[model samples]
Target chain A: MAESKWTPKEPMVSAKDVHKSFGDLEVLKGVSMDVMKGDCVCVIGPSGSGKSTYIRCINALNPIDSGSIEVEGQEVNDPHLDKLELRKKVGMVFQQYNLFPHKTALENIMMAPMRVLKEPKDEVETRARELIKKVRLEGKEDSFPGELSGGQQQRVAIARSLAMRPDVMLFDEVTAALDPETVKEVLVTIRDLAEEGMTCILVTHEMGFAREVANHIYFTDRGVIVEHGPPKTFFTKAKDPRTKEFLSQIL
Target chain B: MSARTLIPGITARATTDLPVLKPFKGKPYGHDEIGFSRFLANLSPWAVVCVVMLLALWPMAAMAQAKYTIGDAFDALWKWVPFLVTKGFALNILISVTTMAIGTAAGVLLGLWQISPHPAIQKTAWAVTQAFRNSPWLVLLFIVMLAFPFEITIAGVTIPIPDWMKAVFGLSLPIMANISEVVRGAIQSVPTGQWEASESLAFSRNQTLWRIILPQCFKRMIPPWMNWYAILTMATPLVSLLGVEEIVTLSRQAMEGENNHPELLIPFYGFCLVIFFAYCYPIARWTISLERKFSVKL
Candidate 1:
């Protein structure tokens, strides 16, 4: 609350006293956090705990009822904020790979850059191919989402977000829908992104994966950060009983 | 599921006379007899039905010698075909095409308005679509015919409103309503996830609607759009009641030109039916195929 003790550099994403509700049901209850530059923050919690809702609120995908969310000094919670400009910096991939079914894998990655950013065609196409290869989908550039396997589609979705050259990336249980064998490929892609210093926030059930790739872990429960620490400390020596209980059940 | 053998060699090992393979051989018994039975098996059901219908109508064909000879009917057709094409048919097409263009443009706006976040816009769109959609097409046609000004003066110049233009305006109301429903249904059919993904990409509401949402809706909207067009085309004859010189009116005039010949009455009306069928049947087939091809999997 005083300052983000975690970061020496400026925070890329900061949420302060965020409160959100759907009708009478309040989802994010005074939730706050700081994701510094290059931080891979993994959010883990039970299903209805508002983990996904919190990350969505960061980019104004879901508006906060009260509080402030700032990304790169831009007030995301401001009503008059240029949301399109804000969103260009914060790329998100969904649990179900929401790849545009109408576009090919390359076009899916290329469209936002070309249309939204008004980037040059050749430049966008070249970058899209690079992102495709980064996500380990080199030859699948021309395949439709329906033609690809679940993992391949998810990887393409990741590449699509990366194509925007976003300052921060959000993954909402991206590999949750994949088969067990296919999960590794998607995780590997995310790990590669993290390794290359792309700031990421992941809401995941994969504790082992979170432990492996995440720099910091935020244990959320009932719309609050119940526990937060480095993954090694958080997974091994979580001080809160709720965090321990959640970890015990999951691990 | 049974584990079917994938290898052709394995299938061949089971039997020498494989039915699936037998179709490929030109001479099954080492004889060059491509029989009539095999030829008949290859024919489509539609082709067969046409042949059978001609066979059944042979007696009727022979009976046409009585009052109006086939030659006389052909003569009537020869005289009327060019007249219908040059005058009445062109108007029918103009009416259909103009109504379609205006209806579709307004319908898309109305449909998008139905989903507008603003409550007043939504309510107005709902009322407009429901009002037109619920009314009888003929009643609406009559109402437009009577309600619109017969002539208008813009500045000092007076422009007369043609009866055909009135019919087009009337037809467009119902067409617009139906198209609004089609557009609304198509947009609603898209999964919620698409909206979330597009929104997260920071696309403005207009960008999301026009670029992301509308493109996806095209596949769902097209079949019904074609279906509505065919129905609209067929209903163009209803304009004759408003005294528009469409096909039916032309047919009546052509009949009267021959002294209202009772003998030629069947042929003249039947000619209208054939023309309508010729235009509509292909559209019906095309709409069905489009429905099959672009049936939304999501």
Candidate 2:
């Protein structure tokens, strides 16, 4: 496939025919996608379709069996690739809202910047407070993860990822574990981030949220990207039978 | 007793006050009776053990000739009480504390190595932990006491290793192995999500362990660590077998000093049991409380 004629800036994240496996099971077979700067890309797939694995490969969290993933033009699969450096630029929020349970909401957001980046405490605290408010957890700065609702914890997790000042954000079904009522609050937070032009690749089951927020949509099935296009066209006029079947069941 | 008096919480006065019923009359057999029985029921196991020992020793004391009475054994015990506690038991406490400190430090490292990404380090640590964890503590104590040189020379300077110190070193080997299991279990108890979250935040593995993983494991490790300390304290008597002059050895010497009367055996040895039980029982209770307090909610 030729490069898109319209993307003026270089793709911030690019996966070229990425192949990954876990022992006997092949999770990702020649998967590829380009996430441009400030674009919201949604990857919607069935449970075993390797959507999470693909994004995890992008951040070097899981190395690919065979293929290339580059973030900001640095080869992620390189043996000598400084994963810490790659992760600094690419932030991920887990589906479980993996907030540090022992830490307060504010401290959770402040931790990476203060510890990993060695940022000054006062500066990190000030920014952390702002991010807490950005996620609309204003009065819960001191609340530990166990005390917070699932939505509140998920929002704090997003704020934690944002604390690193990352170039790209990866959301691995961040709202999947939330109560129905609380899911909107987390979605609104993500929508606000997208509107502010943060580069994002979300692997989600929330198709309605995807169509509303994502500029591009990729439908994965059976370890491959079966169809992808602009969300408007991709949702309505999916060409692949597998994509149509998946959309029919979920929608 | 009147039917009304038999009803719970009704006093004899509240029932019918009759001279014939006066014998059975007082407070109802409610709270006070339950309280007395509960007191007996809740009696410390240590106290029960002491009572049983006294009861069991009484017959032997009675069977002894008129030459040395049970009262004579008491007098001998009273004479040596201060020396036995201050010198002998103090060594036991010292050895336990020192062995625990050394074991904990070494065990934590071994535990970390057991989970190291490197196969060689992980295997070696696992083998070392298994080797010491399964070996009998007494056997290890004997090996260290007998095999280790009494002193060593380094840099033209000689440092003498005391017998008690050697006993401490021996005791620490098993303690280290057991503590290593404790540390490994504690670390593994923390969810994998923590590692992934820390990784995404760009924390190095070392940073993740010290900053994220270890702090959580610390609370989980404490109760078990204290439990091990209690076990170590009880096992300190094994050092007396090596003739390191701990409580048991001192008690034997004290009996000898009292002309080795056969009646001296009960008081001297029984005192050692009581002292050890006194020291370890509270720790066992505290460890249980700590375990409850620190148990992970999820």
Candidate 3:
């Protein structure tokens, strides 16, 4: 196994012995991982491998049954933890855009900032417009999500998450739902964020994007991290038989 | 479609400025310069209304000679309608508005309670709402009307609860119960992704409901709400059984006035039908329009 190049300083997110189950089906079996500041970690695995569940646990979106997760010194697994407050520090983007159908692209980006942050409308509008432009949805600001294409809507979703100025972003198959031609735009937007040093944890099937954007590659299966290392070695020199098997099918 | 047509300033700047058209640059049309076609278009709405009214009243006119003339029935209507407006119709409006206000507020609370995180609270609210919803409106009204006293002592002082108040309370109980179902349905109709997206944004449960979920629900609830309101309005006539002197009571009194001719009975009842259709038709149309406007895919 190749060692991680970046040494841990102030870990942005740390999950220890995290386990989650859906009734009798145990999805997460004592999975553990750490995401440090500015680390672009890509989580990869097969279907029902708990890849999505593990990342969701980091933000306490999926409540862990055992073990703990801490993000920016906030104990996410605490019984009294303020989920709303914890979520503000971590922005999440899903495979489905989930943009408010009623709201315009600009409004979708502006909503959380104005309502949750209680920021001034003018300030939020300025940042939201900037983010919309950043997402390459400049002229489409007034358009509603229903009017936009899949790629455009996904970009708006990214901009909406970025509008909160989150410290860490969790992307769960952000581009998985996109059409082939439109997928590039969303990947490029995420690549821009990763290059900007935004601490991101992504569960994705795009091996090429993962190799390019993610510094650390974690191979997860049946709810645990079976192997993790630098992308160069993890892809080319994976030690585990399972990682090799998973990579073989995908790559 | 061109910008020049929309903003006449462009035309004014483009051509030699005419004093006649310059003053009306921003207005829809210039005064005393009406186009014949545009004037016809403007009058179309009033013409349509007149045609419909004529068609509606024609049936009464054709049946006029058979009994009391339609003219006499209308004259009687003119007299009794004003009397009913001040005495009976006003009460209907009051009962309807009051019931809607009180019922909607109580319903929202009960509906939210039904979905409360606590299992006990949820089940309790569910049971109470279900009980109220399952009971017939008239039966429920009768029970309240018969069970409660006219006055109740509170802090050594008696507060009078009049018959109308009893009727209002009775009407509101079922309204509240039905509205609760509407509220529950509307909330449930919102997709789970909306909740997840809003929650992931760090919005509190209340915030998510009020800002994200409820706004979307408001659209889904409107058509059903308006339908319920129309039903409630028609049911207000039932309060006449409790001697409330509402529209139905006044209609009976009006019919009794012309008992000698008795043939006027159909016209009197027809008047009530017209009143109800006049009130409900627009509401139904408006609800449909709003449904189309606010339709969400997910």
Q: Which candidate has the top score in TM-score?
A: 2
Report how far residue A214 has shifted in candidate 3, in Å. 1.3
Off by over 4 Å in 1: A1-8, B1-86, B254-270, B296-298
Q: What are the lDDT scores of the predictions, listed in order? A: 0.83, 0.87, 0.82
Model 2's i-RMS, to one decimal, reads 1.0
* Span of 10 residues, lowest total lDDT, candidate 1 chain B: B29-38
Which pairs clash in the backbone of model 3? Answer: none
Q: Candidate 1: what lDDT?
A: 0.83
Q: Once superposed on the true structure, which residue ranges of model 2 sit more than 4 Å away at CA?
A: A1-8, B1-43, B61-66, B296-298
Candidate 3 residue-wise lDDT, B1-298, digit = tens: 2234446454644343343443645543111111222232234344545654565477576666676666676677777877766777778878888888888899889998988889999999899899998998889889989998999999999999988889889999988888888888778878888888988998888888888888877767766676667678868988889887788788888778866354456556666666665665566666555555655344
Candidate 1, residue B181: the lDDT equals 83
Highest lDDT, which number?
A: 2
The better-scoring model by TM-score among 2 and 3 is 2
lDDT at B262, model 1:
57
Superposed by TM-score, candidate 3 places the C-alpha of residue A224 at a distance from the truth, in angstroms, of: 3.0
